[model samples]
Structures are given as C-alpha cells and as structure tokens.
Target: MFKDSKKKLSAPATDTLLANGTSFEGTIEAEANIRIDGHFQGDIRSTRTVVIGESAVVRSDIIARDVILAGKVFGSITTEGRLTITPTGELYGKVAVAALVISEGGVLDGTSQMIRTKDAEPSASTDDSDLETQSGTRKDRDTSQATLQSETG
Candidate 1:
C-alpha cells in the first residue's frame, strides 16, 4: 500500500542508546538517533537526532540534525533542524541552530546563532532565497542607518 510504503520510508532504521552509569569518550558518528543517559566526553556527529537524558552529562561538541537536551551540556552545539532544551536541561556553550526551544526551567549561558542554511549556502547563482535577500538588505540598511545617524549627530 502507498501509506505503508510512506510510513516505512519515514521511520528510522536504528537508534543508539547509552544507558545510565555508562560512560564513553571519543567521537561518535552515527546515522541514527542517539540517546545518552550517562556521561559522554568527546565530539558527536550524527545525521539524526541526539537526545540527552535527564541524568546525562555531555561535555563535547555536538552536530546533528536535531538535538533534545534534558541534561547538562558544556560545549558547542550545532543542529540543522531544531534544538529543544527541556526544563531540567542546562547548557553552557554556544548554540547554532535553525530553531530552538527552551523550557521554563532550562538554563542557557552562551550565545545563540540562528542559522539559515538556505541563506548561508545557495544552491546556484540564480537561486534566490527570501531569507538570504532579506538578511542582505537588512545588513545594508543597518549600516547605512548607522552612518547617517553618526554623520548627522
């Protein structure tokens, strides 16, 4: 059936799990989602999502499509999709994400850069993305406004 085929295509094949009391140190590269409940110290690169459990502690750079943090993290994070920090989550490093959600009790102590992938990388010379054009024009207008204000004042 077409619905069955679509469901199969959308489902991920595998997911990695790091249970409580476990510890890992090194770079982790996976194509599936990784859920960490223990301690991890190193770089993590995944095309899928990375979920840090409530008891987990991660101290490394994380790059993934999506990231859900319910624990403590102390390094840079880059997500192409969305980054969700739960109420119990604590983040102490810079974040680069297209979208981010922070719960009421979550704590973030670093800078956040909202990255528009289409703006940052155009497909072709003729490809005109609205975000890119808007951002460019906004930058130009800001610069011109600043110059005019300074000159007049």
Candidate 2:
C-alpha cells in the first residue's frame, strides 16, 4: 500500500541551508550538497558539491568535487570537477579547477588555473619514445658527464 502524507515528510537533502542567523567557524565535510546562508570562517571540503548562498559570507579555503557560489568568499578554492559562480557571487581568491563558469555579473579576483588531473600523467608511448630519444643521444650524455667530471676534478 502506498499513500502520500498530508504534510511534507522530509526536507530536500541536496541543498543544505545554513541560515542567516547561524555562524560557524570550522571545517565542513559532506558527501551530498551544502548551501550556506550564514557566516562561515573555515575550510569547506566535500566530495559532492557546495553552494554558497547569496546571503552567506565565507572566509576559508574550499575543496570539493563541484562548487557553486552565489555569496562572498575570501579564500582560495580547489575543485576536482567544476566551479560555477553565479551572478550574485563575489569571490576573491585563486582557483584551481578542471572547469570554471562565471555568470555575467559574477565577480572573481585572483588567478585561475585549469588543470587536468588525468592528463598530467605522461602516456606510456610518449614516455617510451622520450626515453628512446634520450638514450639515442649519446653525444649529449657524454658531453654532460664529461663536464660534470671535469668540474668535480
């Protein structure tokens, strides 16, 4: 038997609201999603996603899979996947992420570097080819080794 409750049984879990009246100063770790509407003064680390609500004010570094900001943040941010700044968001920090999106009215200060984690590893073929090329350059190696020996002597 399935029946709907007259009243809402549970609240949505995707969006966690730290209402305006609350203030926290510590690291926040969550697997789902988090939204802050209050003042926070610490690091925010998550495996899922994070959203800084428009009324929220944060002053700490952030690490997450994805982050959406619509508030004020005064710290560096590192995202494994993507980072999005909404029109009302104001961010002032360096950002390292795979991808970034900033709305027209969003404000971002400091540098942003897009890095690919998987691509950082050299391919097997490339490594092998590089090794082969280096090994084939006998003259270069000999000259360098000779110079090192002379300097030591």
Best by lDDT: 1
**Root-mean-square deviation (CA) per prediction:** 7.3, 11.4
lDDT at position 152, candidate 2: 100
- In Å, residue 14's CA in model 1 sits off its true spot by 6.8
Give every collision pair in model 2: none
Q: How does candidate 2 score on lDDT?
A: 0.85
Assess the local accuracy of residue 20 in candidate 2 as a C-alpha lDDT between 0 and 100: 87
In terms of TM-score, the best-performing candidate is 1
Q: For candidate 1, lDDT tens digit of each residue in 1-153?
A: 345543211223338988899999999999989889999999999999898889999998999998888899999999999898888999999999999989789989999999987867765655558778988999999999999999999
Model 2 residue 75 distance off true place after TM-score fit, in angstroms: 0.1
**How high a TM-score does candidate 1 get?**
0.71
Residues 88-147, model 2: lDDT tens digits = 989999999998989889999989999787977566676777787877798788999999
